[model samples]
Target chain A: EAAVTQSPRNKVAVTGGKVTLSCNQTNNHNNMYWYRQDTGHGLRLIHYSYGAGSTEKGDIPDGYKASRPSQENFSLILELATPSQTSVYFCASGDAGRSSYEQYFGPGTRLTVL
Target chain B: AQSVTQPDARVTVSEGASLQLRCKYSYSGTPYLFWYVQYPRQGLQLLLKYYSGDPVVQGVNGFEAEFIKSNSSFHLRKASVHWSDSAVYFCAVSVGSTGNYKYVFGAGTRLKVIA
Candidate 1:
């Protein structure tokens, strides 16, 4: 089974604080993504990376930035966190191997910004 | 722009009962459809997907879905649901080629299974 692991499963931050969430995948997938989940709002993509040193903005990328330092690691950064940024964040990895359609997600990080 | 609509916000069913979660998509060309389940405090897991050929596809945990191109719908169904099946279900669609990996998700449907 493909394994995607995320760090700091639960987080609490004050407004204007800098917060970072990390993810690692052993599946050797070429694509990684960040998303936030909210009640009644569903999951919305924030950022995605094609590979190392490549990051692309998603539908809801305004207050978030993503980094892929290596093929196995991806990080979501909140430079200046705010109350609105409080939500459950998920990291996912997908391999375009004949099919870019399916994405495997890691356990989410619940962020609370006061 | 591509979009998905999961009209039901919540669904309640007794254990061992049949299940159906509605999902509709709006996109030009052949669409790539998917269903994912998110358990409490867990990540979303792919339940099933439909690309072409088969109108009905089976997934894990006795779950399945049927694609009706005429109505632009891909509804998820389960013959006998278990209590562990309670979770939030998301319907998603990717426009154009799947290689592009662009996806649009619905608001989600929360399922509550009564034992």
Candidate 2:
């Protein structure tokens, strides 16, 4: 079955520390996205990739950076983590065309920055 | 700019009762609409989506949504609710024919089913 997975389901980091979150997708989709879910605010996109070596800033990309080293792997990096950045992160994968825009999501990663 | 709105912040219903979650979108042009459910400590899963064709679309777990273009609303409903149905429901929107449109999601409505 097509699936998306994220590692380090729970993490606690100090402010100004470097944090990396990883995701893998077996869906073989061309598009991948990283979103943060917060209370009273819905899922907001941080960054996305069209494919390998392609990363694009999303709605809220100020404090985050993303890397797509390969077709199946995408990583979100926080160079200087902050308490405000603590939230549940979700990674998703979708197909290329408009007809296949529906995305599949990972289990989600809980990050807490002290 | 495109946006999605889920008016109710929370809803509580008794088990075996009916359920309806309201969702509205603000997009002048035709758009894709979807309903996603998130269980406690879990990620979101698609419940149903409406692009074209029938105003109503059926999804997993006996869920369904009706797209009313005139009102710009896509409301999800279920005839009978179970305790397991308690979760957060989010409504999202995007351009249907565009390949790069990022989905805009609503704040989400937390549904509580009391036994």
Candidate 3:
């Protein structure tokens, strides 16, 4: 079983506040992703990293930034949090060497921006 | 643009009843289809995947999905439903090159199994 864990499972922040969500994976997967889940939007990718120190923008990366400091850790940062940015965030890791292209996800973090 | 669509946002079924959740995709090239289930307050779990060869793929906990190329649909089905099976199900499509693959997910279907 691939293991992915997230920190600060629940967070509350005010507008203009900076927030960071951390994720750690033990699967040794090279690909890590950050996504936000909303009521009708499902999961929208915000940022992804192919490996350590390589972060790429995804579909909805405007208000979010990602950092992959090491192979086991990834973080999503919100420079200036807004109420609109309030959503459940998920982190996922995938191994490109695998044929299935399956991603293992972490228990999401629920963020509330007031 | 490539996209995945799950028409039903919510589904209600009684225990022991059959189940089916519809999913459709719009893509030009061959697609890698997947069905994932998210339990309450938990991460998404891979239920099944269809890359090639088999149109019908079996997943964990008696769940299965079938890929129909003609309709661009990959509908998940279960022979018998259980109360514990209630969860949000997502359909996704893998696109892009092998190393640079990106997944496009649907809005998801929230299933409610009543005993």
Candidate 4:
């Protein structure tokens, strides 16, 4: 029951528009993440991947940019969007050989930069 | 420099009542705790996790959590609560290792279940 799927969901850019947020995982889990849930700053890791092409840089990675061309897909790039990059954006999938690494989420994308 | 503290941002129980949501962590070693549950737009799930011997772990629905390494704390429990259990409650901490782990979240705890 670990299926992470996200795309579009809700968006409305305009600052410099180039937004793109999409993630897909069918349990193949090899680690993949990109978070951004403000409101007191709860979730913040901005990019992560450890399979297919690799890409890592968490702890609020600047304006954001990431892509893992394989291993079930993972992408989060906002080339030039602004308005503080809006908010709510999450996509996770984990399987560090499992020992309770626990992670498998995707049901968010609500961005809104204007 | 790992951190996670959920010093009660908001909590209000009622229906059947009985719940505790609080977490703290500074990380020095032996840490890998988690307890998530976000249900508004949805995105976080997994209501229990603690690496190492049992310190009282049990999750999903009934929920439960307790791992106090000399009070670094990892609180989250429930005895009855219902209102769909309200929402928002996160507390995570997973320092680096094996595939480069690093998850430190905590600024959540917004449950409101009244009758």
Candidate 5:
């Protein structure tokens, strides 16, 4: 089955520390996305990539950076972790050319910045 | 700008009862609407989507959604909901001429199914 897996299913980081959340997709899809879920906001897009070496900012990209080094891998980087950045992060893969279709999601990584 | 709205923050229904979750969208051109469900502590999963063609689209778990172009609404409905059907539902809209587009999601509606 098509799958998107994220590393560190749960993580707790100290404030001001650096954190990296990794994601890998076995479907080899061209589109990869990073989203953060929180109460009352649902899932908010943080960053997305059309393909390898192409990362784009989404609606909320203030404190996050994304990297898509290859078609099957995408990573979300937090240069400096903050309490506000703590949330459940999800990685998804899909076809960018067909945006009207569904995007498969990973289990999600729950991060808590103290 | 494209936006989605799910007015109710929460809804409670008894098992085996009919269910409906409201969703509305705002877009200039023809919009691509979708409904996704996320169970507790799980990732979001696609329930149904509306692009064109038939207004009513059937999805998994006996869930279906109808696209009302006039009202810019794509409401999800189920004939009978089970206990496992309880989840948070999200409505999203994609705006753009081509199929490749970014989706804007609503705050979401949490549904509770009673036994």
Candidate 6:
């Protein structure tokens, strides 16, 4: 079955610390995305990549960076963690061409910046 | 640009009762609409989607949604909701990816199915 896995299901980091959340997908999809879910806001896009080595900013990309080294791997990087950045983050993969359809989501990672 | 609105923030229904969740979207052109369900402490899963052809799209767990172009609405319905149906439902719009198209999600509606 298609799979999207995220590392560090839960993490607590000190403020100003750098954190990296990793994601891997076996779907072989060309598009990968990062989104943050917060109370009342649902989920907002942070960054996305059309293919390996092509990352793009999303609606809420400030303070967040994304890397897609290969079709099956994508990573979200927090240069400097902040309390406000603590939230549940999800990774997803999908097709980017016209045939692009539904996205398959990962289990998600919960981060805490104290 | 595309946007979605889920007017109701929460809804409660008794087990075996019928339920409907409203979702409205705004986009200049035709869009691909989808409904996702997120169970407690889990990731979001696609329940149903609508691109074209049929207005009513059937989904898993006896859930279906109808697309009303006139109102730009795609409302999800279930003939009989089970206790396990309690989850958060999100409505999203696909704005196309030619120019960094992004999926815009609604605030989401939390459903509570009373046993």
lDDT of 6 by residue, A9-113 (tens): 999999999999999999888888999999899999999988899999999999999999998999999999999999999999887453357888999999999
* Candidate 6 residue pairs in backbone clash: none
RMSD (Å) of each candidate, 1 decimal: 1.4, 1.4, 1.0, 13.8, 1.5, 1.5
> What 10-residue stretch in candidate 2 chain B is worst by lDDT?
B94-103
Q: What is the TM-score of chain B alone in each candidate?
A: 0.95, 0.95, 0.98, 0.33, 0.95, 0.95
Q: Candidates sorted by DockQ, descending order?
A: 3, 1, 2, 5, 6, 4
Name every residue pair that clashes in candidate 2: none
Q: Specify the highest-lDDT model's number.
A: 3
Give Cα distance to truth, residue B8, candidate 5, Å: 0.7
A20-105: candidate 3 lDDT, tens digit per residue:
99999999888889999999899999999888999999999998888999999999999999999999999999975853689999
Q: How high is each candidate's TM-score?
A: 0.95, 0.96, 0.97, 0.34, 0.96, 0.96
Q: Chain B, model 4, TM-score against the native?
A: 0.33
- Select the stronger candidate by TM-score from 2 and 3: 3
Evaluated with TM-score, which candidate comes out highest?
A: 3
Q: Alpha carbon lDDT of residue B110, candidate 1?
A: 96
| Clash total of candidate 5 | 0
Weakest 10 consecutive residues, lDDT, candidate 6 chain A? A93-102
Ranking by lDDT: 3, 6, 2, 1, 4, 5
Model 3 C-alpha lDDT per residue in residues B2-104, reported as the tens digit of each score: 9999999999999999999999999998898999999999989999999899798999999999999999999999999999999999999988877787799
Question: Each candidate's lDDT (Cα)?
Answer: 0.90, 0.91, 0.93, 0.89, 0.89, 0.92
**DockQ of predicted model 1:** 0.75
How would you order the candidates by TM-score, starting with the best? 3, 6, 2, 5, 1, 4
Kindly state the fnat score of candidate 4: 0.68
Off by over 4 Å in 4: A1-16, A20-33, A36-64, A67-76, A79-87, A90-110, B1-13, B19-33, B37-49, B57-63, B66-76, B80-85, B89-99, B102-112
Each model's backbone clash number: 0, 0, 0, 0, 0, 0
Clashing pairs for predicted structure model 3, backbone only = none
